[model samples]
Target: MPDTAASKRFTVPIGPQHPALKEPGHFEFTVDGEIVTNAYVRLGYAHRGIEKAAESRNWVQNLYLLERVCGICSHIHGFAYSLAVERLANIEAPPRAQAIRVIVAELERIHSHLLWMGVSAHEAGFDTLFMYSWRDRETIMDVLEGLTGNRVNYSANVLGGVKFDVTPTQADIIRKGLTFLEERTKHYLDVIMHDTMFLQRTRGIGVMTRSQAEVMGALGPTARASNVQRDLRVEAPYAAYKDFPVQMVLDTRGDLEARFEVRINELFESYRLINQILDNLPEGELNVRVPRRIPAGEMIVRLEAPRGEVFYFIKSNGTDKLERLKVRTPTICNMTSVVRLSVGHQLADVPMILAGIDPCFSCNDRTVQIRQADGGAQPNGLSSLMSWEELRQYAIRKYEAR
Candidate 1:
């Protein structure tokens, strides 16, 4: 329930329970008539303590846990973690393993983007687009299951390499699926670009200038829509991306329509890349043996997830368990853009604006670290950590004062 005590202007609060938001997040939009004058957002309701949980699990065990970080892009989560661990162990996945990883990653990208498009369309009240897109998405889902024996997690990536391989039969199935999806995706692109009804909801809506995107730290398609070339695949190639490079899809309009264009065009790119990997898969062992005890050191893995850059920081203490692990997901970085962009838009447009970023609330809900303004080191060079009890009390005081 919203507080009864109020200010001069009306404030509309949406979620931690709302029809528009599928996940838990709270937003207060201060509107004057139909125009939003200010906006505020609060996340973290879906925090799963995955990072803290990773500290207790062994290196191989954490692979499963971390992949659950975001179901939509689960393969990328495991891919990033395995890459970071391989660096720490001073080993690399075999060339064929790397190529297989890329194929699976691209397949996941197809799944994620299609899922996001359906959700975004639903947010816009376009049930037709939502339904059709989701129906086509099952094609990719089926291909993934046929290849890896799972629809969502896939669990394809292990420590040194992947656990699965692409057989000739699986390759034929994937090619057929891609052929169907490519045609459907092309139709989606045409619809978003020329549909009169859809344009009213997306074109020029939530327009963020190029400078604004750069200043606000937009990532993935959000930044790329603003013509910010921030794809890690092209900038810092990894895995099979080093062998089979991708052309970063970009758009300069910096609006909802541009985002749709950039992502749909990216689907075509993913399709091309997947076919390339399957045709030129290298021959080698899937995985290699690694010692149970990893050397004491720290490493960071940055990968271009379906959603921009997914960052991972790992600290191994020469044991099976990790000492410290931190993940800064793309949604957190893009959340700032959502709030600032919502201001001055219509009240009804907020949902579309929020969905434009394809947020994964749970994935972004990591532990928060409070630092000094100067970003200087604390005493003993270790930053202070906020406890749950202290944070609860702080929230109480803040609300009571408000």
Candidate 2:
């Protein structure tokens, strides 16, 4: 017999050259006419095996290697790994070094969010907004360049502490740039909220409930947009977050509009936190001496990367090199939510929904088959064939049985 499920739904393949964000992820959207019935994702187009590579490099060399994991949130990778190593060695970075790390990390956040805003806008065909957002983002990039001497992959971290200190002049420069960024951010927020064209593409699209977010392991603004309250910065407070606490920004709408609002609002919160750190800058050494070879231990470190929580598990055998280094980036955790949410929405709206997650395909370049059944669709293949409730229950049962 002809496969009824295959006949009822046709698959739409979205890229190794993706339509959304120009990323290297392959998404198969099974649609019945215009409405999407199911979605599946296949990654690994850009995986460089950074985790396995970290095992071969020494403690100092690993910092540089892991920093290349994501060009946008490079510093956070280094920051998280260094924290794990320091924890294993039972060493702490000085107050000054910790403060500087926070500064760069926050700056990286602003840079990443701005870039996301632009790309998401472009995906929705708001090219003018895209251009303006990217133009403003350059300000953060310039500040990062001045501070770290490289815009991307800033190797500002070392084993025990930071590689550099924030000088008074550099502090003034960062403050001035941030002040300008703050003003521009307000304008962008207002535009996104009020622009009818942009609103049409974003609002009410990709709706995810708080329960769904938790069940699917959504994190960062993706979860916060649904009012999930799962920020590592606010909840866990690693690095300097404890000293300069984050003011969580949330929305209960659980739609694309909420995601856009949460991220834009976070830019302001990040600005506030960065200023707080600068004003009460700590005094101490740039770096403490960490032993060339770390003591034997295993530790997990989590940090709020631009997308969400970046998890690093480090294992050492009392050697200069690590035994194993495992990295679970935010993109992988959030990909489940993206594929799940894409169902029952219009196929035209797929790009906006995909962009809403601010997906970093490169960071999540691992193969995953989220559903063992034929896609997320029922055999009959109308979107209503299987309700989200049924789908959720099926997922729960499948995983629990495992």
**Could you report the Cα RMSD, in angstroms, for every candidate shown?**
10.1, 13.2
Which regions in candidate 2 have their CA more than 4 angstroms from the true location?
A: 1-5, 366-402
Q: What tens digits encode model 1's per-residue C-alpha lDDT throughout 1-402? A: 564545458899989874254888999999888999898888878788899989988999999998898878889999999999999999988999999999999999889999999999999889999999999999999999899999999999999988987889899999999999999998999999999999999999999989999999999999999999999999999999999999999899999999999999999999999998889989989998777888999999999988889999999999999999999999999999999999999999999988999888868974345443344456677656656677788789889999
Worst 10 residues of 1 by lDDT: 367-376
Q: Please give, for residues 246-297, the per-residue lDDT of candidate 2 as tens digits.
A: 8889999999999999999999998888888988999889888999899998
Q: How many residue pairs clash in each candidate?
A: 0, 0
Q: Would you give me the overall lDDT of model 2?
A: 0.88
In model 2, the number of clashes is 0
Flag regions of model 1 displaced more than 4 Å: 1-7, 18-21, 366-402
Residue 180 C-alpha lDDT in model 2:
95
In candidate 2, which residue pairs clash? none
Q: Residue 327 in model 1: shift from native, Å?
A: 0.7
Please provide the root mean square deviation of candidate 1 (C-alpha atoms, Å): 10.1
